[model samples]
Target: MKNIKIVSLTACLAWMLSLMLFSSCSNDDANAENSGGGPVIESVMPSGYNVDGSMKPLTPVTLVDPKNYYVIHGKGLLTTQKVYFNDFDTYFRPTFVTDTDIIILVDENTPFADASNQLKVVTANGTAIFDLTVAPPVPTFSGFNLINAVEGDEVTIKGKYFLDPVVTLAKTATEPEVPITIVSSSLEQIVVKIPANANHRNLAVTNISGTAVSKEAIGTALYDDKLYGMQWGGPWSGKGVNFDFDGDSYQGEKSWQWVFGGWDGGNWGFDVDMTPYKAMRIAVKGTKNGQVNFSVNGGSNYVIPVTTTWVYIEIPLSALGNPASVTMLTFQESNNDGGNTVLFDDIGFVLK
Candidate 1:
């Protein structure tokens, strides 16, 4: 009899448990019917939405119908939400859904959320609302030309749309890659130093945003050998020779002063103030025997060199080594009897 009682009690308990589960499931079905089965998307959060992810000052979003959107606080129906892009988590992978998308509306410090057509929607039904994209502005370079230049000469570069602060010069067939010194800059102009090995080089502007490259151009030239020339003097006229007549030889029976001052100085001379690379060259002809004399400090005396015929004289002020200012050059009669004539011509300077 006790076994029968135990079995009957166990059966009663199972019957009661089944009744409770069935009642719970019936209640859930009745609630679903009352609420219309799912959250109704009566309105969208952002109305007339258009924004660029790459643009500064990211755009804001709004609700098409604030009352119907079911906003939690100030945000829209899907308000107080999180966005993920490109991955499963919202950490560092933030992506935009098109150039103008909802991702742009997120705060800067918020973690980037993984995004997908399947990952979008209200987090209830997996549905994609917007596409993600990025639009970076294309950079351009202008104002480029090949200037007459030497290998190590310094030069200035001018251009437009150099948005980046730093400038890059790519290596050429004749020169190595180099970066120019950024002295000053503007929207349309940038001033930088030409590197020592810069030649036939390609230029570019760089920053975090993008780079702008200019066509290759030659470096700039500073010094040339054409800085000096020659001229012919009198016997032709009363006026002195202007270093314009290019003659292989010149002859005269009269003494002519090869005035090296003024423009003829080639901007060179001896100086108490130590300067650099100053030189003068005057190829003179004594057609016959003559004495070449030089003086400094106003001709109190003369240092003479007796020459036999035409010869080249290179009077590098550097060789003179800190001589007095206002020096003089004169060719006189070899016998010192006076009236002996000598010719002077072919005046030039070496600039290197």
Candidate 2:
């Protein structure tokens, strides 16, 4: 009876030890899973579908397009904290994250996106780096400054994707293209000198990606000089008159409130000879039917009729005594009775 009792006790002790060891091992495994070791990026893929709407396989891609969705294959992605394209933060969804996959959307407004294509992923455990080639969208042509420009004058073209641009000018669609000298080039702007004999026909820019042609002829000119392309003036407040760019055209807004003395003005003075040009052409639009006065050399006032729509007002230099040297050009609005607004653009000279 004594030997039987000892054997039973030993068996019970052994069983308890086995249970304790098993429990310990199970706890360790749970902790390991909760920690989610360091993140590892395997590959990046683009998401798209076929015509039938069937899901496409997550094939690896080297290039990424802005404003598009992509999938990242990796481990420990569930704990991802952030994703960056270049230095720009992008959007990602935690719900889309799995132990081995993550979904992200590249930001459309990523700065210098094509210039720097390094993608970085961060997690609590570790970070991963990937090299991506970014393909930017095709270029766009909005408009340019100095619509009527003379030879040797710098004309700035504004738009998008101006990388390694090639600028050309022609008198008409049928004329041969003439290359203009580029003074500077950037992603959104290019400054070039108007070549001699440029016919003011069509101005176009071609980059490696695409091309943009102006909708209208830049305006006729053989010898032209731009005084104010809406890039001047001082700080003042009244009924509120200001100069700004409206994407498609330069604008001048003027209010004839009593607080503003019922007038707003801007002036430019240069030593350019106005004898060669026939008239000063200005593109303007007003709130209602009114008249605005323009003065050159602080001399006679040239009254221009304003309509609700835009119209070109040509003031003959001959009307201002055909000044031998242009000292100043002034624009003033004082005819506002109850207050009025106006927009002006393409302030320059027209060749005879």
Model 2 per-residue lDDT tens digits across residues 218-254: 5442112322333334323423534443422332222
Cα lDDT over the full model 2: 0.63
Query: Ten-residue segment with the worst summed lDDT in candidate 1?
Result: 66-75
C-alpha lDDT (0 to 100) for residue 218 of candidate 2 = 57
Per-residue lDDT of 218 in model 1: 43
Q: Give the TM-score of candidate 1.
A: 0.26
lDDT of 1 by residue, 1-352 (tens): 0001112334334433543353355444543453322222221122111233221221222211111111111112122134432323332112221111222222222222222322223323223333332111334564332233444444445554344457768654655557777767765666666666555456777643357765324431111111111132122123333333333332111223332221121122222221322443444554345454543333433333434455646566555443434333322333444423344443323222
Tell me how far the alpha carbon of residue 29 in candidate 1 is from the true structure, in angstroms, after superposition: 22
lDDT of 1 at 18: 43
